[model samples]
Target: MKKLVFIFALSSFALTACSKPENKPVQESAQTAPQESAQTAESTAASQPLAAGDTAETSLDWAGEYKGVFPCADCEGIKMELELKSDKTYELTEEYLGKGAGKEFKSKGTFSFDTKNPSIITLDKAAENRKFFIGENFAEARDMETGEAIDSQLNYKLTKEAN
Candidate 1:
């Protein structure tokens, strides 16, 4: 439709107009030529590496296998294993034990880090909503919908497996 095209064009123009150019020179300079040159050099150095906007907060190492036994009401426990790979994919396996017939289930899918908190990860296209709060040598399960950590003495937690 003409209105939709107009809206799309308007949105693109607004985004481009508002976005800041990385290579733009600093407006203020020092009084002396030597100081000015030094300032420019510093500015350029600071901007060069970060022109693509890579930051430590957005990049984290969370690749490993985690295992634990979760408490279950009717069964002895639920044995859980989760593996996260560097390519943002994951494998999850679960086994219900001591319920007359032990059953195992495995799910494989891609995962993504939460934009607000990179330490939190969620499974994509999974049958059951699952979220993990990643920490040193451990990944803890949280409320699937709210992403809030469950509070208990015997918390549902997974320890990283030895490489």
Candidate 2:
């Protein structure tokens, strides 16, 4: 009788340990289905905002190379090269000439233009003495190089390079 009781107890313990509860499978399935549906709904909602922000002209059309030359009385020739990116950002390289012997002084800066008025370019440097201005065309940039006022004839105009 003792042996039979011990065998019965051992069998019951093994069956209980090996068998999963009746509600476990249903609970797991319910939890996983909701999580998956929530993720799908979130992803579908997230994509709408990105699509809304995208328009036909979302990117700047002015992304290209440009060059300009301004005649300077104090310098040999003011030559400027600009590389514009689709994000409305640009890199500007300028060479200034000394008044008499055509000595060249070079400088560079990063620039960005307002999306509303793409013609208005803002230039900044690490030195923190920055200036902003608006121009109708590239040639109208009076403050391209030095922020100080220069002679009127020293105005520079930017021209888009032919593809």
Pairs clashing within candidate 1: none
For model 2 the local lDDT of residue 102 reads: 43
| lDDT for model 2 | 0.57
lDDT of 1 by residue, 1-114 (tens): 999999999999887766645223222222466787888999999888643234222444568899999998888899999999888788999999898346988999988777
For candidate 1, the per-residue lDDT at 111 reads 84
Model 1 Cα shift for residue 58 (angstroms)? 5.7
Indicate the TM-score of model 1.
0.62
- Model 1 weakest lDDT span, ten residues long: 22-31
Off by over 4 Å in 2: 1-60, 97-110, 115-118, 126-139, 142-155
Clashes (candidate 2): 4
Give one digit per residue, the lDDT tens place, for model 2 in 1-163: 9999999999999888767664687789888999999999999988865452343234324556667776866666777676656664556666775654444443355565535444455555631323333332232454445543345653555776766
